[model samples]
Target: MPIAVYVLGLGIFTQGTSEFMLSGLLPDIAHDLGVSIPDAGLLISAFAIGMVVGAPLLAGATLNWPRRTALAALQSVFIAAHVVGALAPGYGVLFVTRVVSALAYAGFWGVAVAAAVVLVPAEAKAKAVAVVASGLTLATIIGVPAGTLLSQSSGWRTAFWGVAALTLVSLLCSLFAIPGGKVSTDETHTVCAELRAMARPQLWLSYAVTAFAFGAVIVTFSYLATLLTDVTDLSEGWVPALLALFGAGGLIGMAIGGKVAAAYPIRTLVLGAGTLVVASGLLALTAESTAATVVLVFVLGLAGYVTNPVLQSRVFALAPGAPTLVGATNTSAFNVGNALAPALGGMVISAGFGYASVAWVGAALGAVAVPGALWAGHLQYRGPRTGGVVAQGAASQEDPAAARARA
Candidate 1:
């Protein structure tokens, strides 16, 4: 809804491309750095680990800084890290650069989310979030493919160079577009206060729902190609196009959720999470049916992504005391889901279950989120006060109209 939101989304596209494009470049990187493929894969792990650590750390450290300043500083660091990574002489240097770049990316995400919500009216908060998060979907659809093409035409180093150049454009757009101000003028957002806000049981419940619901999506997605080829009997050539279709589904879901989640957060979560369970279960059951599998895969992406904006908006609503820290913690929860789901799916496959079983595993993971969302909704309705239904911190910032709408 705001220019800054789209600018931040553009920045996220660059970072997400950097995050995922490496999957395609692993062979080139391994060959160039004289390492094994698995060893080159560790670079992705390093970035995930960095995001988990840096989101809260950087958000806390820069909590008091101006939002524009923090964003600019983080993007600058990200671009610098990419440049260094492109020129890296050895695997070790490239690994370190990847971690550094992820830290910047995570920090930027934490700050950008907090800033995005406050930039719009209360009714449009989820829309703002969807706009920003759409960048990641776009990255999956457009940026990663373009990076792979670039790497094939030039070299893997050229991909990194391209990201650095793109990030410079995003950085300039962010600095020029985002308004200058701290996320909150409230003086109570001290470190101690932020820590106290983190102690809310309801907030943690929301995080669990985020992790489980989002993780369910990743479980199936992480193994999608294998499932498509082995179960659906498609060839390797169709993988990219089908994956783009999934990304398109995500964009459609986000656009729809953005329009509705502000008025129906709990409904959005329940329905979205329910769709994940159904889609995954159906996918598991119908894996051998080519048409069924294709349709279910698209449903999986739609169901998975529709919950994102609702999950994010709920966190800000539940923990208004420390938007930066809360946002960062939620970001970490997302990465946690990302990390754990793939491992769980891998374990399921290792246990002699076929790739189709991973979809069942995803269904189980999505099932876990349903009650969590219900529990959160129960807390929201039956808790202490009108505005601060879930936590004392939320009362200070919760929109009365939204509170009444929820009522």
Candidate 2:
């Protein structure tokens, strides 16, 4: 991995931490601001909605600009999000800020992945995506945990301030570390071109893989704080620690996911999905044991995250013609999963199912992804020249060896 990769990784951490930490602190914000917890939950939803809206909106709007310039500009938006979040006067202000800041969130990750892949050897593309995504995983481990602690000990506003500072540092790091380049020349993606990529049966299968995989994870995570406080019989004080453990698992998974994808991307996802099958059972079973619960949370987190790098790489591989939009929209797919899981999980919980039911819901969600991975595996086995294997656009090499061979 290059130094620039590490720089992007760190920047991602700050951005991710800022984005996710709000969930853990939702109760605190609600109480202080005199709103219901459900209302506070909107802060998280608002951000996702922004990402869903922004990914395509920003990517299409910025379609013709330099990647580096677009990335730097997104960081500026990140800082602005922090400002609004930190200085938010009331719930309405906070809600608006979350959405606005989220616009940066969706666009940054989308553009970052496309640019990050080329920074390393072609074989390392998944690793590079994992490196950038590690920022997000680290946010779960370090960023969200620390921010929660800050919100508890100081003020929630202080947590926003800290994130603002983090984003500022991310901005500086991106400017200093990333080498300058044009990145791509094929900038002609018609509405039909994008739809054409989507038309690929394998691409839709890949989208299903991402949507379900991420949905399962978010279903578990979105309600994690409640599970700890309500079912596990832990004190409010211990929730952040448990959440940290969950995130640490994500960090570990993200760190290794790239290398794993490099050696056997399809197999890794196959194996990862199977773990979710077991993890969901274990989480439901172990909801009463602190130690057992801890281990299960770690396992579930790892299983959920291990598939991320491979999925992103697969989307780009399937749709390299419009890599920017493809990457952004794939991110939208993942977020769509995240968005839906919580809604479903919330429904189960509201219907008087136990908090542990989220795990079961997650398992069912994870199962949907299996066939998609199997389909992609089948395609990989069949070879690209076969009837179903259409390169959605010019190939952006997922296999550096394959790219080099063609070169």
| Candidate 2: count of backbone clashes, pairs at least 3 residues apart or interchain | 1
| Candidate 1: residue 32 lDDT (0-100) | 86
Tens digit of per-residue lDDT, candidate 1, span 141-227: 777667756766788999999999999999899889999998766789876798897787888898999989988887777667667
Q: Which ten residues in a row have the lowest lDDT in candidate 2?
A: 387-396
Predict model 2's lDDT versus the native: 0.76
Assess each prediction's global lDDT (C-alpha) against the native.
Answer: 0.80, 0.76
- Global CA lDDT of candidate 1, please? 0.80
Clash counts per candidate, in order, are: 0, 1
TM-score per prediction, in order, is 0.84, 0.88
Best by TM-score: 2
**Per-residue alpha-carbon lDDT of candidate 2 for residues 289-371, written as tens digits (9 for 90 to 100):** 88888898888788888887777776776765666678888878887786677777767776788788888988888887777
